[model samples]
Target: MSSDRTASHLARNLAALRHARTLTQQELARAAAVPRSTIANLESGEGNPSLAVLVKVAGALSVPIDELLAAPRALVRHWPADAIAPRHKGRGVQVRDLVPEPVPDEMMELMDFEPGAVMGGTPHLPGTREFFTCLDGRVILMVAGDRYELAPGEVLAFPGNLPHSYQNADALQRARGVSVVVLAKAGV
Candidate 1:
């Protein structure tokens, strides 16, 4: 299945489970340790959650992670874990692998982004270079006092050591995109 479909499916599952229990966005946010807007976005089908999020939400709702994140028609391309949920680094942003896990040691996986999302404000990790491309909408990228607004089909590449963040320029709709981290060759 496509990333969009998978994201939509996960969002739906989260919404259903979150609402069925009479939990407000704020309540769920507290229980899950996510932002209230994140919950709103998930329920509205405009956000995707990382594996950590899936786990926290499941724990708060008192259910198994599989119950809220299983994809009926989507099977893992490799290990079963790949089909479970993608893990993320950073906060206030949803991220998951776009490909199967145990990504060849030579390569890394993609981090998915949603509308109005920003990766946690932290220093980027070393030993890698990162790139991004907008899949469906515009994205505003800011780093080291520089800012760039990228439209669909545009791509940006940069060293991953600078502090960085992103935002969806759209006032509405999901600003879908992917972050590619190509790890530097060892002993470079």
Candidate 2:
């Protein structure tokens, strides 16, 4: 491909990757040990960066150099239900992986709580956050000595490092919820 094409790809990929990680240009520059203007210029497709700069940026993003130069591809991905196996946490609790593939610093799970079922949440690293949303029925969430009752479509956000647990509020109905945990970046 031509240099302009390669630069365009790099600009798009770099911006997308940075946004996906929720990093500012200044933050990425600090991580890559480059000037913030360098990142800004690169993302704008106005910089013809040196090989050393590219290598540093790639290393900071934890991606290969080829990815920065490759043509953009569709981001949509489909995961069939049967493709993922559910984990039985206990007699009445089931947890299914929402994201089958490993994602850095993030995890998502679909949880089902049978009548009167309870499941304790595992604490994560400091600065991690957990978001739980009730999709069906009702769920009782206990965190840090506080109790929250969540109905369908209700959401609760809390520190992932806190002691927390979930329980089905109904005695004869099953409760379903989705939990998304975002972990802190290492060394940050």
Candidate 3:
């Protein structure tokens, strides 16, 4: 979406969420540590809130930041499964959960990498980006010949076109993570 559309959408959602919570403009302003005029301007669709301001608004609304910026659920497209393809013989790289269908230009997959599983170097398709978050055990993700270890709650996003792979650090525990691969629908 264009930045203008995004800003307007966020402004509307913020205004709706704020009103739904029965918060007055003054109340929201105090809670978010921003001026009342800022909230008013955002609600009036005359201003753009920075990410930091959005976070503050999220805190004020007691919701995740993404909740305030998501498109309407009905309008979100299904994520195609074909975009995610993994090569390996290890136990930790099993596909667990998919977001049902391809979500327009993006795909999300939850992969469970079994301990002792490792994938050797192989470059990803050009124009692709991989985003992973360590959900369980430590995982070693290699990108462009460099190794990086990730712990639970940690996230890594990089170009998929580079030679990349992931290794399970231990066999005693399961190494699980979520890999969100984003591919261009046409330009790619």
Candidate 4:
């Protein structure tokens, strides 16, 4: 999927889901705790949505976060970096989705970590697990109060129900890595 198509899918899916529940734009916005304008922009495919916004909307709709972002798909989807890979920026980090369509129970993302970048994540539902593999540089992952240092080619796996955080360990170099999250129960 290209970026344009991704936006179109989001617009279509959002509107369809909202209508399916007989929700007006304002109603859905209230449910999602977002401004009506945000919902309008998202449904019009005219604005960038942060991960937090997507999460809130999905929760309000009683759907998975991926349900809002994934494109309709057949088997054997291919995500070319230049096309469907929209880099989602955080305070000091960058992330790209690696899957064009949502899998039954999984999420994959590529992360670029600038020096001093830190990301904190709340606990996922029970039975969820997350894995991280360092592709370049180093990072310190803190999960459930346990800190683990990961270098290139190293990997770490842990239950996602634990509060977690990560930071680039190298003060002068950026780090890159892949993160895979598995939900024990699909679409939960």
Query: All predictions: root-mean-square deviation over Cα?
Result: 18.4, 3.1, 12.3, 12.5
Judged by TM-score, which candidate is best? 2
Whole-model Cα lDDT per candidate?
0.69, 0.92, 0.76, 0.84
Q: What order do you get sorting by TM-score, best first?
A: 2, 4, 3, 1
lDDT value, residue 8 of candidate 4? 84
The ten-residue window of minimal lDDT in model 3 covers: 96-105
Candidate 3 error regions (>4 Å): 1-92, 120-124
lDDT of 1 by residue, 47-116 (tens): 7678887788777777788766557554324557546576665443556666543332223344445555
Query: What TM-score would you give candidate 2 relative to the actual structure?
Result: 0.77
TM-score of every candidate: 0.48, 0.77, 0.49, 0.56
lDDT: which is higher, 2 or 3? 2
TM-score of 4: 0.56
Residue 145 CA displacement from its true place in model 4, Å: 1.3
lDDT of 3 by residue, 108-150 (tens): 7676777778865335567878898999999999998788999
**Model 1 TM-score relative to the real fold:** 0.48
Cα error, candidate 1, residue 123 (Å) = 4.1
Kindly indicate the candidate among 1 and 4 with the higher TM-score.
Answer: 4
